[model samples]
Target chain A: MQYRISFPHMGKYYIPIKKAMEAFVGNYGEVILPPPITKRTIELGALHSPDFVCVPFKYTLGNFIEALENGANVLFQIAGDCRLGFYSEVQEQILQDLDFDFTFHMMELNGKNAKGLYEVFKAMNPELTLPKVVSTLAVVVRIVYAMDGIEKYIRQNIGFEVEKGGFERIEKQFLAEIATAETMPQAGRIFKKYLKKLKTVALNKPAKPLRVGVVGELYVLMEPFSNYFIEKELAKFGIEVERFITASYLIFSTQHNVKKILKQADGYVSYEIGADGTDSVAKSVVMAKKGYDGIIHLKPFGCTPEVNSIPMVNKISEDFEIPVLYFSFDAQTSETGVKTRLEAFYDMLEMKKRGRAL
Target chain B: MKAYLGVDIGSISTKGVIIDGDNRIIANEYLWTEGNPIAAVKGVVESLQKQIAPEVQVMAVGTTGSARKLIGVVLNAQIVKNEITTHAIGTMSRVPDVRTILEIGGQDSKIILLRNGIVTDYAMNTICAAGTGSFLMSQAKRLGLAIEELGEMALQSENPTRIAARCTVFAESDLVHKAQIGHKKEDIVAGICTAVVNNYLNNVGKGKRILAPIVFQGGVSKNVGVVRAFEQILGHEIYVDEFGHLMGCLGAAVLAKNSGVEQLFDFNIQEVDFVTKGRECELCSNNCEIIYIYRNNEVLDAWGNRCERGLSA
Candidate 1:
């Protein structure tokens, strides 16, 4: 019997996860990607979610329900440390009470080790041999790196492209090409070819553009739908956005670099605050030192670590003579209100860029 | 003869102004929105048109405030901007070297920091609207006094009783308690004014620098009591223009003139038959509620859908 496994979406990291699932499940299991989030997804999640849980929880829960409706029988949940860990047990209870026929698989890594991940793959596909699993994992890791390499270049230059929607059009094509590649070398080739094509795109960006560094909660930073496509809005105004977190960065690199960031975040941060808090604090200081025009601290409502970091963020803003805009987003937040704040923030940054800062 | 028009259709108040090439305010009007932005905009435009001479012809129009998008579409405004930009530009045009602007409108308050005629930073009050003009007006009504008298009475207080203005409900109860304890009428009023100033500084102006020349405007700025409290707390002179409340509208008009997008603005919008209607789309689960503004049964604009497949922004 085939076990249809479904996973939650984080940015466009679904591409690599899809590749890994294809290799591991082979013909035994079907991988279901929940549809792109909308107002209905949020409303569905909110009805069942605990009133005070962060928005990411609500969004992912909504994903599970949608996938379940579409014939998904197995749910793959990544319940790491922080409030996210509690999501699995609560979500399992809710789905079971709803009388859905699904097996929930909660993947909790042993401090970012691959052994736990191997077990997860084995649990899903009992027939998978160790050597085959290792090869698939290696290829999956390379795909993550490849996706990150191209996405990073796109974010920096998309705002300045001479032709409107030129960057997105090319990236859409790249996503299509990468989806078909099976081997690690094929993925590498696709990334390099796309990288060169992106470089040739005509750009009319100035010598110095208004640059904003965004640091905050992980889920909010990674998901555009959750943040109301803020990065896209900024790009519309030709403002540079440096969001320092991606799926590859969070999963692969954060394990090694978080300790170093905590040390660098001394005086600004007291301890290892959960859910990218240390990284947010450390990244803000680095962005300030790098002469970024402004900083934006984004968080979800009732986010403990992000709330705790507010005072320090403000203090850093004062010390470094850079302005900071804080946004705590929820499902209830109006699109127009967010737009107004963004316009004002851009206006302030432009004024400062013209040497009008107080 | 050439002129520009600006309108600020806020949640509570709708303001309009007309200015010439030199940025001179030739006509201005302020009217309560009364819960309908489109109706309020038409009313304010008519009021301004009546005040101005026939020789003046509005070349371009601009809109600001909460209902800027709606009004921009209604009036065919050449420029639509947020409150921060218009407020700073409005105050700077009047006080060329002004460094700060404090605006407390009917239901909301915002602090805009400017350096050499450009906004550097700003913060808007996000919590409950306790320290707004409307709250003070309600408190004045409960005490059987006109809103204007509270400001005048506050000027006479020798020892103002302390009232917690952090929350509107708490501040109202505290005022009632102070009155029961035999606190002087003027002192209680003065205390309420002080509470508003304290709340404004604590929440909106928390981390930012408050510098001069500071121009205090908005509907609340008309209250002398709040002005005096700001002066006492900051220990600096506060400048209030006669038309301080109309600064946003004025800024819009000025920006419209400078926009260089010349569109013949017909100020006689009262004669136009315009209305907006909304309906939900059922093509997807999103159920996007699309709104269309119709002028003489013709679609002017439509927005609020998520994807290009439907009628969306």
Candidate 2:
């Protein structure tokens, strides 16, 4: 049996590519990485998709189309929050509409939907044993956890380093070394060494360098695709960046943290900001009092909660004498404009600090 | 002597509201967004600066809207919030007992359910523009009637026609069909109003229990026809505040006041020149277009990126 496996885009290709190649080679044949996402892929997806569908929907459809064209008989996609959960059926319809010969397996499509998943696996790997599939999934989970751990540590400390590019260089080395590691222990060793080296890179600056806490809508913050890399750019200016949003954090600790965040705002107001507004406002206030240099809030073009929380944030900024910058991202927004204002804000803060000393 | 500044930037319009500590509206201006939030915000800020009394200093600045962040950043706002929270706060302050909020703006509509003065559940339709202010504007244009006259014109009908109220395509076709059949102008206007309300009810308010006292807001709240249609469909009286379009801005002002901490903010943003650039991410199939902002050859901020690929770069 010649099995075909595919992975999407850069960075994710590292582990999945290795794993797929190993697993398929061990069983039957070879693995092929899906063609890079291009304008053509998006066009194809748009052509086949329902008009005015969300951009993600069109892109995912295009990915599947490209994968099928590359002779991939089996497709894998991780299921999660938002519209991604329902995208599989929609994508399947579009694929079937085009009459592609392929089998689809969406992991986490309700754990109880085991029979359907098993049938898909059986078709892809007729000699597949339940134990083997479980073990493969376990390995993949471990790799994901390890990658996430490395990413989390790097994100928090990368901005604090005294020397520019030190963290990134080590991060690159760590990724390269980890990719070559055959076992979890080797990946762990690589992570530990790089983390130590990262800590040693002195990040000493003025005791206070306009610490800006970025808090707002999740998509505009985490996805980088959505917010246009605001956090990284802020970090480049040596601003101590604090953003408490991530897919992992949202899934694991959001419910628990939300209560704590709300409780922190006890005396100010009891109203919620709809969706994540409450959380953003709470976090922004906390950061304001924490003596952070400034606060930068980001949200999507049409998001509601962030819109509601602006007043509260302004009040906090007024009360604390701290500056807060807000940014809304959309397709037409100019990055040049955002950066110019940010630099001016940074300069103004620096001037204020100098004037106070005088 | 305490004063607050509120900036509400929506898809279609950007509004600025200045209020005294006693919650009295001092100065307010509403202008079309013209598809550029940055320019609209700049216009709002410039207009607001001129409106402020020389004797009364701006104690706090708050921003709310779809473009709150960008505007907040540009204006150096003290507080920034989402539209729902801003609207809820604004409405609760004025009408204290609002249980439901039906906000239909230029490009979107939202049905917010409030229980015991707190937002319990809410649904928003941003993808579709059929039952929003734009829909009304389109119909008004087709009928050669100004949007402001739609409500009273609709109310004038003794016998209202029933038009399709699904997607824009079906609604437009039904309207043409009704006109071809020589339906009275008033009846057609009433039918269009009912159609828009029906579309909103089926899409945004679907699967949600709407209870009163319901508050209708956003730019479309000014349309009495929509308000009447909502009341007829939900079988409850709907209230539209005099300053309905300014609710988000009002909420932002209220929040600004409640924020106990006082900071001296300088509104000198106009003195600085800001520039921005755009790029596309090639790392993922998502191909998210990103923009990078620069000030004096230094990267000030970046946005529009989808994932981590372009973030660090």
Candidate 3:
């Protein structure tokens, strides 16, 4: 039986994730990339989700349901801290109740070790060698770093593109090209080619542009659909957006730099609150010290980690004398409400810049 | 004489104002929106047109409130701003020292914090409409009292009963239970008023520094009971403007005056047939809902699309 593997979507990281899953399935099967999230996805997600569960649960469940309906028989879920660790079990049971036939695999790490990940892949393909796994993962890591590098540049410049849709058009092409790479050098070459191509895109950015930083819950921060494409919305106001958290940054840098990040927060946060909550406080301090015009915090409704960090974030805002806009996204959040707040924020920032704030 | 035109079309009411270069109100009119902002704005514009002097020409137009975008297009507005900014500007213009502005409208409520003539921060109620004008109106109807009479009755109550107003459903059931349990009508009415005020302060006004010179505006400000409740709870005098309901339009007019952009504002929009239509673009999986405004079969503007495909569609 050939494996038709699928996973949930999280922003543009789908490219690297799909490549990684393909490497794992290799010749034995094919990876099924879930369709891009839409309004319908949210509706379907909310329909099956338990009332008041963080929205990411519903979104991922909806993604699994869609994947199952699309002939995928295998689903992969990565275990996470907070409420996310229990997602796989509950989602599996929900799917079973819905009478879908599929196998669910939940990958959990063992205290700063990736042996759990290796075991999961080895179980799926008993003949999988350690050398093969290491080489394949090396390429996947490069793809993630490459995608993140391109995205950071795009975030800061997408709002000021001389030709509308130019950045998105190239970014799409870049993702498609890099997804086919099988070696580290090949991945590096693809990243270089796209970076050069992206640099050539004409920009109408001002010498001193309004800058904003976004720090929040992981799922909402990474998934544009989940957060209503807030970064893109900020760009429309011609504000340079700087987001420090990416899949690559979270996996590689955050683990090693926790101490440094906490110190940068300047006693605002003494220790980790919960998953990614402390990082949010630290990043806000960094953004504030860098003189960012504003900061937007995005999270699913009743997100405990983010909710715990709000007081510190507020204190940072007070100390730095910078404005912070907090948005709690839910299944039924209205687009008009988001737009209204954003437009008002831009107006406030503009006025503040001109020394005539209102 | 040169003047500016501002129209604020909210969920429940429509307001229009004509202001001179000195920020003095030349002519103003207020009317019910009646679920048709276009018609309500036309009535307001027509009424203001009749009140203004014959020599006074409308130099520019501005629009605020929920339907600002729609009406801004219809009236050829030079400045279209959100209700928050407009409310701050309008309040500051009237009382330069206002530190806090508490506004409760038909379906929404917001608190604006200002410092030294600048709006420092603001927050609007999120995903809830429990403690707004509409909720009070519905409860008033259920109690077999006129909307205006409910407030008067509340002012007579010696003690206001506590009502659960975290959610509208709970508040409605709690009100009925109180009425059935031999609670005085005035006490219940006063309790409802307190509930609205408490809900607003707890939710919309949460975690913000609310200083003195607090100017309360919006339709709900017309209710003496709510005004008194605000003053009692905040332990500060709450100033209600005589033209509180007109603050939104007043701000819009002021903004248009200062925008430095002018166009001959024609009252002829009252005679123009403007139609708005919403259609879903199915070019991709996104299925974006696009709204188009039409005048004489020509599309004036289209929005709510996420991609270039909607433009082509």
Which predicted model would earn the best lDDT?
3
Evaluate all candidate structures by whole-model CA lDDT and list the values in order. Answer: 0.84, 0.70, 0.88
Tell me the lDDT of model 1 at A46.
Answer: 82
Ranking 1 against 2 by DockQ, winner = 1
Q: Each model's DockQ?
A: 0.49, 0.04, 0.54
Once fitted onto the true fold, the runs of candidate 2 whose alpha carbons sit more than 4 angstroms away are A1-29, A35-44, A47-61, A64-358, B265-288, B292-300, B306-313
Cα lDDT of model 3 by residue, B35-106, tens digit: 999889889999999998899999998899989998998888999998888888888888988999999998
User: Could you estimate the TM-score for every candidate?
Assistant: 0.92, 0.60, 0.95
Question: Tens-digit lDDT track for model 1 on B1-313?
Answer: 9999999889988999998898889888889899899999988988888998888889999899998988999999999989888888777778889988998888889998876667777888764688988888899998899998888899999899999967889999999999999999999999999999998998788888989898999988888999999999999999999999889888888888888889788766888888899989887888888989999999999888877877733
lDDT of 2 by residue, B155-262 (tens): 999888899899888898899899989999989999988988999998777656677788898888888887888888889988888888898898888778777645
Report each candidate's C-alpha RMSD, comma-separated, in the order given. Answer: 2.8, 11.7, 2.1
Q: What does candidate 2's lDDT look like per residue over A1-358, in tens digits? A: 5777654443333463457345534566556666765556657767887764445556557767887898876666656444556667777777888899776667662323335544555666667666565555444444555566666665555667766788778777766766665555665676677667767777765566657778886656655534546667767766767766544355444343656868876545476656668878888778877888777788765566777787787677667767666676644456555654465455435535554100
Whose lDDT is higher: candidate 1's or candidate 3's? 3
**Candidate 1 residue runs with Cα over 4 Å from true position:** A109-111, A254-256, A263-267, A355-358, B137-146, B153-166, B169-189
TM-scores of chain B, in order? 0.95, 0.91, 0.97
In model 3, the runs with Cα more than 4 Å from the true position are A109-114, A254-258
